[model samples]
Target: MGTFGCCWKIFGVALAAIFLFFHDLCASEKAPNYTFMQNATAAPPISYYDYIIVGGGTAGCPLAATLSQNASVLLLERGGSPYGNPNITNLSSFGAAISDLSPTSPSQRFISQDGVINARGRVLGGGTCLNAGFYTRAASDYVRNVGWDGKLVNESYEWAEKLVAFEPPMREWQTAVRDGLLEAGVLPNNGFTYDHLYGTKVGGTIFDKQGQRHTAADLLEYANPSGLTLFLHASVHKVLFRIKGKPRPVAHGVTFRDATGAKHKAYLKNGPKNEIIISAGALGSPQLLMLSGVGPADHLKAHNISLVLDQPLVGQGMSDNPMNAVFIPSPVPVEVSLIQVVGITHFGSYIESASGENFAGGSPTTRDYGMFSPKVGQLSNVPPKQRTPEAITKAVEDMKALDDAAFRGGFILEKIMGPISRGHLELQTRNPKDNPSVTFNYFKEAEDLQRCVQGIETIEKIIESKSFSKFRYDFMSLPMLLNMTASAPVNLLPRHSNVSMSLEQYCKDTVMTIWHYHGGCQVGMVVDRDYKVLGVDALRVIDGSTFNNSPGTNPQATVMMLGRYMGVKILGERLTSDVVSN
Candidate 1:
């Protein structure tokens, strides 16, 4: 065989060997059979519901819980039942379970016409049950910065915390890394124990004192109201709406399809009295709306989808947190336990409650000031105007500098967060049966480069700190940065290759992301400040997609809060109308 053929053969052999080694690991545990057997007894169908929530994710659960209190609620989930699914409810190793990325129960792998997309939860509790239980609230200032109703936002957040039982999982968590965290000055103080978290390092919340995962499944498991009907395995194909002479169109209902090629319609029962809430998460919600003719008119036309009520803003703004992580091998590889991985390390809070040159002349809200807001603030220093090819090149150079040291360490860290990115999802096919095309144009944004470089530098500083010294962590530079006379693109070397490079070269190949994807439907671009679709009536999107700016923190809390706030607003509107009519 030729040299290329030889390499391919070896590569194939290696892949096959690796696959066999983890064959069992690759396969997820089989989920329960919720299949309706023909010729067998069929469960009673939900003939009608006052409210029909499209998803069962973090936002969906709370929406169902709150709205179903007095009104009849029907929750249609495309995934399997999470009630007793071991893969979902009992999973302790959040990282491992999600890594499976397979469809279980009624929820099959969500695919577009071309047939591939990121993982999504198709179970009863949706993504909330499957996602990592990292409950960090959006930085309060971000809520205000977006011009959203702040005090009311906080109130909504507080309500969400109660409904979902938000609790820090620090009490029983006991990890040695946590001690290392303390030494490294990364812990935030628990207000219950100290006056403030500012300066005092602390761990993020992972679990509660009760040792529960605090999953949405766990939160909404109790006291399910009889009015809410949960229909598992019902995949929404399109949002059904009616257009009138009024400036805004009326949202009538949704048309959905089941796994067995079955089609059904869940109409709005309360008439103008009821509304359609799309909380189908960042990806699905926008796709469903667009398929039903609710996004940019031109794009929908290209897909041959008939226009019902051209909302134009339906799927324009989208944003998410970029994630990056590394599996640091403990020097001694001690016997690992739950406490070891899921401990809390608190960092002191920023006392920015004061105005003007505060906190040692550092902008309290800025990271330079030591206060990292989860929801708002520009993390990247790259000038917005420089978000072009030339700027992207510069950013890549900067990233190389930050990641150079990481290569020296034994473990290879992958940048899950892509800096300098603006990506969007498009309808691959007119058929709602086919999923939408999702392109996470990571590293496509010019500013992403600078932000990633800063992230790398920050992480490196933490590793070099006195506290982290106890772990004997060292930098691992990639070999490509080594002096080369050729003027070519700085290619990334194979992560598995046994090689070493100079710090300069290592910096050239470094990349990272937070795995937080936000912004396909641009915030403020499509939705108004009130989280309402600009051109559509009775249609509100309450999910991560509503985020105008990516909250640097985990988005679960923000999304949940949005659901709560939106629920209250929609309900309040109804209540006011009733009072006026009376």
Candidate 2:
């Protein structure tokens, strides 16, 4: 076989070995007893579950696994199973997995009202199936702020770590990133630890040593198959409600459609403890709630949908941790790397880096500037004169040179960890199949813009640091036809940057989301501390949507921790000695 084919065959063999190993580990426990396919033919006729969880995503998978330990549970996922999907199992396909815009791709790509391109997972593992795979325990302050018991939170983290999280092997590029972060004055290096702290540290990742990704779906191995039923490609349209002349409405069941458009209704078994939990991510949770008529009455009325509850905050206060980056082109090849090292600054910014062949393929360049399109160029305030043939040719040539460079070097990503600006989600149409309108309102607050500028400035400082000198390239040496001066370099800045180009305008033009969307159905506003939606019984929101604020990092770890916490609470279990000691 050719090299690529040989590699693929070996990868398949390795993955099979890993699967067998994990299967043996779960041998003492019950294997997942659930049904998953394209249709709902295997669904129980009674359709009664002690707990019916929507969106078998990052949060829903683990939560269902935990709850099924004691009660009958059902999980409904809008996408197919993650098992054997190369896009999900192979680390090399990370970019393509998230960027794939095909209707059947696991990721559902959407453009926000603000014109930013983003995506969310439609798969069983949710974001964990699509995200960059970085994992870190939520900061201690985050636990305290959420009013979670510290002991329980710690135990919950341990439970998740034992399943999917792993310590990544340090690569050459990652070590350089660590040195550069420390050189940027991020502070005393904390070495390697999963604890979120103010310094550079290596954390856990879901990618295994064999370069294979293990998703949240793997946690379902702990589930009792007899008690839990999982249905794939089952899109839930709305949460069914019942009112018996009471002031509040109770969630009785859910109405969903199978892949073949067959509709099914799965209700909670009649019991005081039976419930339906919505874990459909930040955008999805609120959209589902609004679709079910639990949002602002006025907004619901405008859509001509009868209101079941007058809760005004169901889809308000959406926050996505916005990110801006500096792509450094290197004439020499760099080693493949993911987000193993991270720099946490005190000023509400987190710095991270990624390097690999995947970075090279995804980087913006002159030849592929069409990806930005006329719309983005116009929104960027690009002057008509700049579109001249001569300028366009020169820009394309420069971009080609960068692309042809031996390696797709590293990228410095500055994420506004604590953004003050808020956004909201609204219905586009009442159709459950249609995507909701998401307005991030990024950089709306003056302080938010300033924070982004600070982050960019920090990135510049890191690039210029002596520790980064080895990775730096001499762009000045390239054959350029444009007016090139040592002081000015090339005119790459936006209008906001005058002599230095508009850093402010550049931010506006280039900013993208890190995909850590949260807080649409926030606590104290839409749900209570116990995750119960206000004015609704037998229903709860248990995903990133329930976060009152961002956890200041990649949110997969925290999302899983929350799922485990909620599962324990629903089971009425106290913190065990083993859990506490771990």
Candidate 3:
């Protein structure tokens, strides 16, 4: 039908070989460092904890570890442990977890209302376990805008960096992409650093020299062993609250269910400071707030969940950085790599690349099922088993053709930095495990569409650059390729087909996700500057959910840094209170 229309399910290449340039800092195999379980079954049915953190993901694990330095902490994760999972551990089998689509898998698949297929972390390390392991801090402007203590922020970052962040060993494909970015006038090769800067730069990664991933869960090793208690597969039902005779409902505890569906209650120790913190991520935090009867009144009434507070901003301002890409096939085999280099444009956009991804990493035991998915935006609605008869036959033929060049290609992707366009998240069901319906409203704003046009044009320059010519496949001028051209300019947009496609239309049709979505329960709306939930006591949401504009190329590093930053701040507050009492 369309050009490479059936190429969506074709697989990526294996790492024909890995370059060993990094010194091995890995010590044996990193497992869960804290006390943990599949469920809280070993504990009493009703237990009291000074702090109950509902998630063990990118932010939750570090937050729990940091808070437990002095205060007793209980961390609840809806997913199982990330340990011993090869799909998540190996860099080669990168896309495996997201492709599995199984209930028990660490990466949970959810198609947004925008028809964009995406995955959420369902494991202890959270998005860090699911993401490409790119690690970079937010720009200085981002920190100032968030109103965080600059010094403490730096300190917190160092603490986490010492444990998890790593300088990736850049190989062939990534090095080419990096050079091409510079040649395209991205300028100022900032070299290896985690700071976000306006130039082509190499950022950090969680995957070490051994190609073994060290996730945020590894940060738990710093946790005080006796003070922290971690429970895996502990799905939080709703936050427990006390509303009687109070100015605002104060969160007291949380009700959760074991994997066996056995309900348990964990309460907070009586204090203004002791509280239930929800670190369930962007989609999850807002969904959780609504489930706890703490969202817009009208929406809550529809589901028959009584409103706790008419804090209408619970799920507003949801933003996802819209990503677009160009996959260039090479005549030569490409080395395997995740995100190692980045180009931060002054116009608030970021460019990055990866190669030789093994598609749907499949099960650790089932390696044969791995196939690299060509992220054709039009195929977002198409599942492998549900393709049209014509499409299915076409896909099979395309797959056979792709089988030859799978290892000889790579993707250079670009995403807008702070998308002004916004969306919202709402509950489709009351079940905690169920993903709430969300619409990112990508390219809703004309400015956002313009940014995509700029980003894509920049991508064209990279493909045309001398550094990338040897590696790039002539997939046609992007506009002519997407058939987003009306009258070809004879030079750039040659008269290919009389398809009435504008660049903006190409942007809209082929939009994909880099998975850097943030907002919902954003600061000043749902949470105070200190990340405490506004108009509510003893309840705070600490995760990417609090970001109005997502920071940096990848948001995981900033998110992990946030966990440590807030932990130190909270601990200081607790110590001050104890000192005053003494």
Candidate 4:
């Protein structure tokens, strides 16, 4: 058999049985009928809604759905629906959606100031539509630290989980990866859990046995469709604020451009409880704030935007969890998998793996995941936009020297949790549609580099463990393969080739984003404990933008949970205020 063929047998006895059960359960569930959904062009030039939500994404969809149970809500999405998109709905074509370079692609690709290629969600379901299907909640300590009620958090998780999450059916490669993690002494195996534990475990997935992805957009099934006005391709340009209030500026309305280049305005109704919320992701929330004159006064002035509030921390404290990986080219073709198993270390790092064809495609001549591929731009000392085909192949080919085997193997990856390193974001132009310039400054702090070193060491141990020996060529560790470059060894690290290589420099050179970036409109900085924007009335920021750190290994579950939790809280507040008013 060829290295990349899939004719190999699928599952062991236990796994095959598990797969059949989940296939029946998940295949029955489908996306909700969004009866209130419409294109932005269908909206009236001026509209009034009890609550207006910008960005119909991961958090916004649930929030709007929940809020609609009592009050009228206007949900604005900058991108089209994910409902009928095969690239997003099917797991067989895992990498196709995000890798599509078209202007209308559901995932928006951007290179950070750190020169790392990254992507952000552009579809209605947000990053949940683009991510590998892992689903896990924040740790118990994380909940308490953030001052959330434990019982309520669990309830919220259950609500979201029941709709989308599933017990992933493990295949051969993932099962072996699980055993290897245990063999490396990441001990006390907590089998099949969603809690963030300090041991090896199998977690929940958004993909079911039939390979269909259930995204955050699926949470809308719980929504009151009658009261929810969902408008797709509604690009919010600026937040409308009533600046002449007594104590601080108040958010009253928003101005948005519809899909056809026509402008529309939506205002909050005459009630103190009515408000506007920014549920855009980490990047979009801060960018919209700055555009609306709520960010740093000096930075806003650079583009001649009138200052609404001089909240200097609006775009401060940006972060992206730095990910490093060791790509292992198996002599045998491995079963296709996403992140199903994890090894959480005592130190702040996570180990996860994925085996399949390339995210972009399976063609041997093409580059795969940029993080795992040989970045010709780095070797040639040229920017990514400046690289050519001939220069790219010649410059970095010597470093990695990989071949078709790369298309057939899996990657063991590490991502540092709660990195101390930080960076800031700023506007590239005044236009809200244009991407802003941002830098994560990965490994900027010395401690972050040390964490990366520890993570790399753990990966080495896993690679050398007894359980994993069968997968490697001639029972060689990653380090051994690089040393004996004679046999076309799959060089995981391009810049350095031997055991004596500086782990620190290797970490810096090979750092990539796992896309768990958070903290632009952070809690206590831009928003309060209730997630309300500081110094602004009738305004709040929900979504990953308000997070202090990326929760657990995956933030999608918690991010969706927050939307439901806060919606309940806000609804309660409304009821209490009505009682007092009466």
Q: Which prediction has the highest TM-score against the true structure?
A: 3
In terms of lDDT, which candidate is strongest?
Answer: 4
lDDT of 3: 0.74
Candidate 2 regions with alpha-carbon error over 4 angstroms: 1-41, 44-46, 92-99, 362-403, 476-499, 573-582
- TM of each candidate vs. truth: 0.68, 0.83, 0.88, 0.87
Candidate no. 2 TM-score: 0.83
Q: Which stretches of candidate 3 lie over 4 Å from their true place?
A: 1-33, 36-38, 92-95, 357-367, 373-403, 473-500
lDDT for residue 351 in candidate 1, whole number 0-100? 11
Error of 2 at 318 (Å): 0.6
Model 4, 495-577: lDDT tens per residue? 44345667786676566777788989999999999999999899999999888788999899999999999998998899899
Over 283-315, each residue of candidate 3 has an lDDT whose tens digit, in order, gives: 999999999999999999999998899878889
Better candidate number, 2 or 4, judged by lDDT: 4
Ranking by TM-score: 3, 4, 2, 1
Assess candidate 3 and give its TM-score to the true structure: 0.88
Error of 4 at 279 (Å): 0.6
lDDT of 2 by residue, 1-582 (tens): 132222221121121111111111101122233453334555543488889999888899889989988889889988877766654445433333432446667767666777665667777788776666788987898888889989988998898888788888887677877888888888879988889999888888887777666777877877877778888888888999998786789999998887777778999887777899999999889989998989999999999887899988888898777777665544457776767888888877888877654343324443322211121122222355666657646544544543234324556778887678898999998877678898888888887788787777777777777777677664422111001111111122222223344567656755667778787899999999999998989999999998867784788898988898899888873234335556
Which prediction has more favorable TM-score, 1 or 4? 4
Instruction: Please give the CA lDDT of all the candidate structures.
Output: 0.46, 0.70, 0.74, 0.75
